[model samples]
Target chain A: MNALLEAQGLHLRFGAVRALDDVALSIWPGEVVAIVGESGSGKSSLLRVLAGMQRADAGQVLYRDAAGATHSILDASDAALRRLMRSDWGFVHQNARDALRMEVSAGGNVGERLMAAGNRHYGNIREVAAHWLERVEMDPARIDETPKNFSGGMQQRLQIARTLVTSPRLVFMDEPTGGLDVSVQAKLLDLIRGLVADLGLAVLLVTHDIAAARLLAHRIMVMRHGQVVEEGLTDRVLDDPRHPYTQLLVSSVLAA
Target chain B: MIVLHTEALAKSFTLHLQGGVSIPVLRDVELTLRAGECVALAGPSGAGKSTLMRCLYGNYGADSGRILLRHEGAMIDIAAADARVMRAVRRDTLGYVSQFLRVIPRVPTLDIVAEPMRARGVAPDEARARAAALLTRLNMPPALHGLPPATFSGGEQQRVNLARGFAAGHPVLLLDEPTASLDAANAEVVIALIAEAKAAGCAIIGIFHDTAVRQRVADRLFQILPVYEPA
Candidate 1:
């Protein structure tokens, strides 16, 4: 099977700090690959590089379209990348406030994606937005309420709903459940798991939470000092991590 | 037909806190199971029975071997299967019932049992109905169906775990001391469940310490010999 996105020899540096170094990964359709590390481990940098939000100092990132055409993400024009983002890719930021229009109504936040994707019928857009609100476990009655009025968890859910309303083939999620209360985090994780499975969406997730990566990712990459120290099946990597750094990272997590 | 087997499977644990001493558990263990057969793992304590089970279930990675199983009409090595493949295998081909229930707080007993079925795409109502039937067969009353199993007795919780394990009807099932907490009557219920599963051509590997239960449910015994090192 052709990979939906592939990156090789990814290298990025800020001053003397190597944010990404020789990182390579391939995400297949419907697969969830998580990049995990402590803060400043280049996990987020890898995500940004792959998603075209940030450029790598060196490397090739190839995106295979549904028609089997390969496009170089690094060399793609800004307009081309924007079209892909609006049509085939979705990015969920760590902070909902970063992704959402806080002042816009919840329904509009979701509807805006469909509009960007060329949906013009007002009633159809509203109906689709309402369905997505319910899909994310939010009440459709809150369609008119601004996301600023919702709790952090609810705002995150709205962000997810907006990102997924267009049913993009591949999604970039950077700690989607980060900054939420533990209980709310679990609920959001459950919702994300369900939607990802139901839609068969391919995902590249960056998280420092080992437990969340285990729960959602099919595969895992462990990073340290901007280098991938280990990569393997999520359970195998967590249960019997071969790399010393990965072992320490796994052992440090407090057992639930 | 052979459903699962292991080849030269080995595992060891490193005591990093204790001067990095390594203790080997299983070494070159070979085992096989066929459909409609129940092979009970037999051995004394510390014979690496649990370790072998964990390796087979992918809870512990194999040090140097393969856990080959027939999944989706193909032989796949569980030792090397990525999480996506393992998840699909667990959903449609393999099932495990641990000794204790990993209780999900606030989830009702019926939902707990029905969850595996739901993951396999079974309708919610149908899955719940099957869960209720299995729970009832194990002597769980309808009155307790809506309540969480967290506060239930050990035997009741084990029954819930067993119901969930058997609910998905996976072709291969692993039971780790499945009836440890159950009473005589509940043990009888488990024995009957095993018989029914075997009759339906389900392949089972289990650890039953109770000789009577083992004799009744297991078609054969696979001994796990401990690897003793020179001290």
Candidate 2:
């Protein structure tokens, strides 16, 4: 039971602000670990650092591949990282506009990841892309439509389909349901939960919404001032928060 | 064989805003359940019945003692189980039916009931067929199966919740006033469901305020006494 991803002693600073302070976390295979806090709490920074998109001032990020070899993600060559991202890892951005190729058709957007993974058969790529679209509850008829014409929730679903089409074992999701209508967010969260379980994905999820975390995460880490104030089982942390900051954060969510 | 038990379980709530006043709800409470038995939690108001239920469900952290249940052929103390173990245990061994239906908005009733089965790796077609069968048994019309339960009446919503809870068919089940919102006929359906579950060797714990319902379904009564004290 080796950790799929592990980070230790992470410290990142921007001028006078400590973006991440001695943060440490691990995600096991097929596990969903949520990092939650208010804005500027460094949750997003930790996700980015763990995903190898951003460098921490000091820390060790270890990733164990399926072949049982552990690699230092922070020190990996850019080429190696790119190959890893295309094959073994997936990232879903908060804004679909940031993750999606707005000009590409939905099917092309999903097929690009397959192409990067070395799937050269055009018919197979299109078929797999259409299957992924259906898996995410999108209409296959819209596969030729560019994402720009889709609504916000539909675009996010398309982004998820594109990121997941290659069957990445580990995913880094930063506010996957952010900026959607409340009803849409709930539906999207349910879809994500089902897909994560179906695919057995190990996820590093960064979200400010406690309810979403409760619904999707197995464990929860509460951050404040770039430090983890509390971490435990999702229900335990939400129901019996030991840290004052975590308690305040949990209590502040308005009841729906 | 015993399916679940609690040993000297204790729980208390501290009010942070009320000058940190501590309210003891349960203290040294011991309870047990056997396969094919229904234990009804009986007590007056504020007697910690719901607290004990929540503790067993891992919604509330126990202050002390063990809430142990047989999971995967081993007696695991849920009070100390980590999130991963707890999730697995809940997925494979424990089931709960609360008084109301709480589901993601816009998820149709059939999918809501079938989702748990789908998570357990059941095929979509079979899971929906089972969910449809259960909902039909509970008198939910097929016309409403494609609609969400958000706008349903209280009794109708509870039926949906019950169907979802029972669809998983875990070895142990917890019912928190499951029939509180149901009519007499619906309550009868629930009694039958409980009987069928027990016949299949599922251990159950329930809180039923309706004495008739309790007498009909409960094999025994576990009384929970209040532990409140004035400061």
- Error in Å for residue A146 of model 1: 2.5
Residue pairs clashing in model 1 are none
lDDT of 2 by residue, A158-237 (tens): 99999998889899999999999988998899899879877889998999999999889989999999999988789778
Off by over 4 Å in 1: B15-19, B103-112, B118-128, B142-153
Docking class of 1: acceptable
TM-score of chain B of 2: 0.98
Candidate 1 C-alpha lDDT tens digits along A42-74: 999999999999999999999998899998999
- lDDT tens per residue, model 1, B72-126: 8988999888766787888899899999887755679999899889888899999
Candidate 2: give the clashing pairs.
none
Taking candidate 1, what TM-score does its chain B reach relative to the real chain B? 0.98
Tell me model 2's lDDT, rounded to 2 decimals.
0.92
